[model samples]
Target: MDRWAWANGLLDMAETLVIQQRGVRLYDGDDKTKFDSGTLLLTTHRLLWRNQKTSDCCISLPLWQIVFFEEQAAGIGKSAKIIIHLQVAAPNKESGPYQSSKYSFIKLSFREHGQIEFYRRLAEELSQKRWERISVPQPVPAGRSQPGRVKAVGIVGIERKLAEKRKETDKNISEAFEDLSKLMNKAKEMVDLSKSIANKIKEKQGDISEDETIRFKSYLLSMGIADPVTRETHGSGTHYHMQLAKQLVTMLHAPLEEQGGMMALTEVYCLTNRARGMELLSPEDLVNACKMFEALKLPMRLRVFDSGVMVVQLQSHNEDEMIASALETVSERGFLSSEEYAKLVGISVLLAKERLLLAEKFGHLCRDDSVESLRFYPNLFLTQD
Candidate 1:
């Protein structure tokens, strides 16, 4: 259901009621003896009959199915009635030779004196629908002409159409860029500044590679944010922080998965702030926003080790699992260096060393720091051997 239509007590937003009358009688095709007493609603889209006792007991007759509406005066002391001709069934095949036309009828009687008004409104709305259908333009084949229809004149003869289309496209582009033209100009200036710096560095150092210069230019190009959400646009400091937290969580999913369900706070800050562009958040703001995640029951949390290195880690992350993985990796090759552990655990060398030291502390692994190269071995393997 459409929210607006639900709020308005309607089936769809396109439906509009022309008549809502209580104490109405509805009779189906050729069934004068059997009638329903209910409230009748006639809309531009459909006719609805709602039973007086049951809320969900209602029948619908779409306007498209209705073929005719004519007034019929009931006798005195009774209500006014209108007969609706409906195209519900196909022509009967077993009928007589002249019985090609087939239809059904519904009779509605209203106790109030607005039957004439209802008939006029229904007629007007149906006429408007017909007019709208007739006014729509139909496609014409190329190089073909009809007596009463417009024809497509092909590319050579449609200069006016091409100009109009081009004008419309340009207008849309202009509207979209009207607010960001200044920022775009500043971005161009930044690119020029980057080129000048690159040239100066090459002249002085003679060691700056072309790849580095290209990377610098690309970074300069990525600095300007096409769309940034700030307090000014999102309203209130609290709302801005909440929105930023949601964006951070969404962006961290891939990197966290790649980094074994955790990432250094420093890396997340740099990446998220760079993506945010001019509306970068402070470290404190990021921290506060992350604090709200616990209350919001998000899947991740902020973790600070004894050495004061903060990280974003999934709540499901387990140190025991990390240690088990480290033990398996070291036992597989008989030993693992810091670089090998980093590759095995899918984390940076620094983080990998931290986990190795922690595992050594817990007696899960033993480190051999020799002059040649430092390596780790599973404690069980070392003990068994």
Candidate 2:
């Protein structure tokens, strides 16, 4: 879950708060610096405080030990203070349709320094524990060193153990897919954890067994899996949801331009999604993406594949010149094959022929065919010289 972090100045960085500034600390959660007037945010994960007049840096606290103390409330005015302890909620990252949960002031003081003998109630007031302590559970000593504890270990997981997992019948495939889906959510975390562990191993290379470290790193690396269940930011789905796809749409332009005036729709999906690494798109997702792309009036088309190789491409729409150039490149080669012509400009024969026809209309190339071969050459009649 993402932690809600905010500062008084920039709303752009704010994300993951059950309520705006609700769980966000007004004191820096990350810094040791003392401040008289500037706002600081403190949290279990990161202390954040902002410097206003100059280059702003937010101080962050990374551990949960920092917390509220009764002594810290001394000399602060009542009107300026709103001291309330809430049952903290989940962190979310999105714009609207927010949530509201009930909270009560555990201790209320009329003024900061006033000793009016006011009340402070926690567990009984909310019917919930006000203070939570996080401590490691005490370990229980083993009764007798068991055979299992002293025994030499064999392979923990045998290949045969997962044979059933891999050998599911076609009917069970759907059910298997559900299990795969569950694994998908945790998959990304495993990948990230591996990187951390690998870095640790590298940091203490000589101190650790080299063979053991290498084997561990390889095993961890092999466990990488893409987790799509993660919400865009908050726990379910979010505002940055379409961000990577949007970026892919933008990145598709250069390759599209070189693909003659049109490309197969499927090709665009492969190329665009590959550029995104693990964030592959479904065909329908790719299509919808292209529709959004077309709305921008980009010189590209979402084309169908009569042959099942659909693509998205920019309208090199200057087909005539492209064909003319291809024919001219061939004519100068004195018998250059079609394969050679296609390679230099990065296109297929089908697209090249389309360009050639356009050039033919412009009188740049003349097609001649024999039983053995067919080819095009520059039109000497239209010679510039």
Candidate 3:
């Protein structure tokens, strides 16, 4: 397309790869271009197409030039395509395959069937507009100040500079959340800026703050999702919940692994909302989305205990494994209460009780009710006899 520019296939500073696919063809509007087969790369700033055979030949179009895009489904004898509508070619656009064009759009034909995922990622990138964030300056080199910039000399000067920086950060935070509509528009920028500040503080002082809540919040902000699935993007009803379930599975995978392979739904809701930044999810919506985890065949599923507590746990967190582990623990201690087991295993008392109860149900353990505490003991009838 005329909007494209000749590129050397190297990414610009701060630009990062989003996704890539092979067997893609470029079209100048509805007409096919010479680039019939190649690898298409989606980066934070550009859409680059590299020749499949001649690696040196490459072209890129800045994402800023894109007005919008839509998918054209695969049909009889045709591959699926993404039609990218573009703004008018800028006068300073670099030399490309075409010096001029009759149309204001281009098409990318995906022969190998990756259009669905490509479209999804592309939509997310556009929504987040990471290219805008790329302009943020990297840390200055040690012992160097920008030309014409004053360098702080003594402790007093350094303290003053720190105070000014803190004031600026506070101001930015205040402006970002002054209005609901404004907060939504600036959420990604604010999150990224806050994370950068937190990282700098950690690198210099070894922690963001002394307060435990602030430290935990900074950790949550560090895990902020770039683009969360919402009805606005995926549509409402079953489709939205299905997409939401998939996104939750991807986002919670690491957190779940760290939390002994399971987390209470309430904890999940808090973490998910915090990681989502301004896009807070409702409890009802979260429950609805989690209900589809099994239907969608995700790595995790929602479970409701007999006592009405709900949890999201990895599929690999098998009941048999839990029961066996609990039985072993009870056997080692001779008898154990849920509270004691919870402390030993570093899990919630409720979950510990559930595990012990499950082992009892399987005849691997026996329960005793006493004035002091209820405890579980290995079933002597089955084990000793």
**Quality of model 3 by C-alpha lDDT:** 0.85
Better of 1 and 3 by lDDT: 3
Over 1-385, each residue of candidate 1 has an lDDT whose tens digit, in order, gives 0000101234543344666656667655444422356676767566666766766566565566667788888687866788888764444222211232232676777654456556777787676563232232333579965687554467853675566557656865997798589889999999999999778886869777899878976875476445654543443346657876777777677668768887878877887788777778789878877776776778788887666777888877887988788877888889988888888667777677777877888898988999978898888755675
- RMSD vs true structure, all candidates: 20.8, 23.9, 17.3
Per-model TM-score on C-alpha atoms: 0.38, 0.32, 0.44
Model 3, residue pairs in steric clash: none
Task: Report how far off residue 381 is in candidate 2 (Å).
Answer: 5.8
Residue 85 CA displacement from its true place in model 1, Å: 65
**How does candidate 2 score on lDDT?**
0.44
TM-score order of candidates, top first:
3, 1, 2
Provide the lDDT at 102 for model 1: 30
Q: Residue by residue across 1-385, what tens digits does model 2's lDDT show?
A: 1222333333222111111111122322222113323333322123344543443544322223222423233353322232434334344422211133233112222221121111122112122221122111222458845343333234533343244335434435877799999899799889999899789968987887778868976764454333321121221112222443355455666556556556656566566555545645567656665665455555565655343445566655664556656776877775444555667777775555555555666677777777766677778787766
Q: If both were scored by TM-score, which would come out higher, candidate 1 or candidate 2?
A: 1
Residue-level lDDT of model 3, residues 15-59, one tens digit each, is 778888888999999999999999999998889999989999999
